[model samples]
Target: MTDSTHGPRTLTVTEDFAGQRTDRVLAACFGDLSRSRIKNLIDEGRLRRNGEQLGNAAEPVRSGSILVLDIPAPAAAFPVGENITFPILFEDDDLIVLDKPAGLVVHPAPGNETGTLVNALIAHCGDSLVGIGGERRPGIVHRLDKDTSGLMVVAKTEMTHRALSEDFAARRIDRAYLALCWGVPSPTKGEYEGNIGRDKRDRKRMALVERGGKEALTRYTVLKAFRVYAALVECRLATGRTHQIRVHFSANTHPLIGDPLYLRRIPAIAKSCPTDARDVALDFPRQALHAARLGFIHPRTGEKLLFETSPPEDFLTLEKALGSD
Candidate 1:
């Protein structure tokens, strides 16, 4: 019922939980804490009933019994701030919008532990970044692939984190990406709908599967055709799935330029391109995809927010080279 050095939390049993097990009752009351966590606390003698240490988690509890729980502060397992910096589109007390460049990992993972957007955010947001999401991810609301350049949003507060996550799940967020593909699509503008899942043969890759896969949809419009060999296209996501754009385009035989995994061989059209443009296309690194636009409703103010950004210098150079031919 009161705060103390032991991180005490008190609960009073009501008539609704008159004959329930103690652990189940506590789990129902504490929405934020998991049942396993409550059991751990009970096993550690950190839970007390009527000022006495409770012994069994399955024991019955009566109405009007006062229970005290000692919950420890979470360990400092979140990523620390580093001095790295990225382009910021907008920032407020609740959230931050960033124009992330290619090669910048969004968070620390097994093969990547440094020079991530999370490291930079820690340095920028300081202690304010603590515990917005999980300790490992901190304020991260969504993710961008390491090789994909894009506009991304991060939450700085728990309230914003929850709201933004809900918005993404409800498909209320709008995201548009620009890509240069191997060939111009026939219809110029259309939607690709399929179920996407991991490839059975290659666990690391995604595939368009007939069953046991999530529904994925990508709507694309051709912006320009480049001499029948390549085309610039803008894709809008109806459902955000892993590698949705790349996998869908590849499946349709129009893989994006510079895609190492999906684009296995050079298109025949490349042989007809001007020497300079052909060289640029051949030597290009990473996928030729950029998230050009992002739109969502503000969690706190109820205002609609939209953001746009151009691709980085390398992408522009490649585009210019291709356009010259």
Candidate 2:
């Protein structure tokens, strides 16, 4: 997808808006733009009046003056490519499907600026991969959390990026996850629906709030159950929100094992497992969740594409310890 940020915008100051603050006038005219943003643009010399750049945001507008603001293209300062290795499932000129290992971040941030999947994709797919993703995320169409290992698809071209994103947004993409939760949810197979939003008290965490939250649905079937201690479950999402699966399971009192953010304490059900299994579950390093399957329509080929990957070795070990045969 391409950036839809507006082009050079021209506004005229009429008699009614004369003597009004430049920032206020622009902000009021462009209801979507904030006064502070207008001020920043003015300070950056993007706002011009009478063919001269304007520096002050508080300056009064003159009647019948033409104000032109040139919005520059977003900077494409992608992180330098790095020689990082991940398991590639499929690749074409349009996209790449891979099994992202646990601990690898999807994109760069303040502290994690260098080593990311984006950097790796840049190195592998070359500079062309930098132009497709709608936002700063170069090739990233969707994301798997840093600790969630599994199948992911990254677009190589803008057409593919927009198409894949549309498919995902329309819920046409087939996706499923495998998770190891602390307790087996009742009724072997069912769907959990809730409105997930930020926890009112804990800003860092997401919760199933009664008001002011996006609706989220997770359908799950217990794949394997270790008595009442824990279970391996297959989850399909109807709506994707930040930490939807983790939040839903946690809200249902069946938080995933090793989920540091959501699993705040050792669950009493752990005592029900054998001592070794209990210890293994407690010692698990990251969230026991994996994006096991991803399927979508290929934009270029007009073909149905699906990719699936087994959980990483560590996840397999954890499940084995939980008594998976």
Candidate 3:
């Protein structure tokens, strides 16, 4: 069969929405498109309220408001080019596991025009994604950061997706991450728990909070320690909160090395590096984090399944470079 990518489906609001902005009403009714995208489409004359063009993004709408929308299509196929690539670890009729690499975004968002894992999965899975998440995610059930390499399981059917989602929410699915951080904790292995919220002082970062934030828990055990500078640590998530590991470690004064937003200055432990190695270390970017292990019960078979993957070669090479003196 020929491969093709389809754009968003056009939508029209048929109900009344008195005194509500067109974009706001549309966003409330359809949770897929963001306010900005809605506004852009409206401004571009793509949206009409009751047969009238929606020029002002804030224009009020009355009851029986009729809204029209133009949705874009998905890409033709997953990456056949240099843009997107995700390592397929396991696949069956019901689900698939991917060893996602760092620098690959899980889904489409602002500033990421292409090369996302979703796009690649679309290319790879094709029609297999039809029953998963209504075409947006295809087979996607969970997500990993573009820079966080590890195994992610995707569901091919609505039943599988819902079942797996419930398992994640209940913490029945086991997620293990391997991270290289700047220092060793006083205890080799222990639990870290706190509420995580946006930092008031730095809006770009997350911080531990006493109130008004989601509760998060991360448990870590040291795998290997570098000379006073950093350690290879294993982290397990009891709850998956955004930036949970990074926030937890930074709060504990053990931020990940090469953390773009967390680490401030180079730690002294990295000084042991030879000149060539140090140069490469200086050029390395992104937090040295990897999701190495994932285990969960099969949605179809009801049997347990486990998956593991090593850190990317770049991560290992950087670690070696740091160790070289």
Candidate 4:
């Protein structure tokens, strides 16, 4: 049976299969669905032959049976922050800061226009959000990528938002990140200065450029290097540029493993690594990057504030897994 939402389709049961059990018939027609699931559907009266509910999974069905099926619509995803607990790291009359979790998108745009941090903020801040930086993004000072978890500041009023934006534009704020890379850098600790811009070949990606790009500065300190394939490193940004850490590291031949766009091909490192370390590198799911520390003067209060949030679970898990090796 087919309905409008399910689109136009016909479910045909062979006449030769008539007298077969309803579960058997459905299992045959639907490929690999479990018999128990078919039985449950039969029990729910969703499966009817000749417009009559088939109450029993064992009930015999005949050939040419007209089966009517109703496929229920899937429930919409309700975000957890709505009417649920949301951790607030810092809050005041002008702005609030949050330790945003990994996998949470910062704002709505195109395909991700809902179920974002902005959506939750809308619910939490209510009507207090004033447009920031001349956009609908209320009081948003800066952004971290969806997969990169860390501290973020949100403005509650236009005044504070403008102040923060001005500060960021002036390069007056300190932003530091923690990254788990595929291999240790040659220098262990050094500064990488380069220009970053959109890749000419792949518009969706960023690339380090010799010219015609924004100047980017990233300083690195080796936090912990394992005999394994990876190293825990801290990255401090002297200038804010898009994809600064990922791009500079990739250009320097030490891309973060599991980074979807700028993947590290470090088979040798993994192979050369000790047995325990190799196993950890193999299991991580995404590029291990985090905003571990951030310090800035309050746009409203003029007070110096320093905030730090530990890496999310995935980062810690990958760290431990690699450390175990």
Candidate 2 vs candidate 3, lDDT winner: 2
Tell how far residue 40 is off in model 1, in angstroms. Answer: 23
Give the alpha carbon lDDT tens digit for every residue of 91-112 in model 1: 9989999999899999876567
Query: Which pairs, if any, clash in model 2?
Result: none
Residue 149 local lDDT, model 3 = 80
Candidate 4 lDDT over 44-137, as tens digits, reads 4466567544455676777666776554443333322333234678999888888888788887654675677877887887755634543445
Superior candidate under TM-score, 2 versus 4: 2
lDDT of 2 by residue, 1-325 (tens): 1112666888878899999988999888877777867875665456778876565677789999999877655554667789999899899888999999999999875467788999899899888887676335898888998999999999999988888888888999899999999988999999999987666566457788774456789999999888899999999999987889999999899999999999999988877888988888899989999999998888998898888888989999998888942
Ranked candidates, highest TM-score first: 2, 1, 3, 4
Q: How far is candidate 2 from the true structure (C-alpha RMSD, Å)?
A: 10.0
Give candidate 3's error at residue 206 in angstroms. 2.4
The prediction achieving the highest TM-score against the true structure is: 2
Cα lDDT tens digits, model 3, 1-325, are: 1112223333444445678777887787667677977775654445655554445567677665556675655443333222366678888888888898788888655466467777776677676665476444566677887778888998877889989988998999988999988768769989899987666566457778774456899999998877666678999999987788999998888888778877777767557646676676667788889989999999989989999889999899988876775
Output the worst ten-in-a-row residue range by lDDT, candidate 1.
Answer: 1-10
Q: Show pairs that collide, candidate 1.
A: 81-123
TM-score of each: 0.76, 0.77, 0.72, 0.71
What TM value does model 4 have?
0.71
- Give lDDT: candidate 3, residue 239: 90
| Model 2, C-alpha of 262: deviation from truth (Å) | 0.4
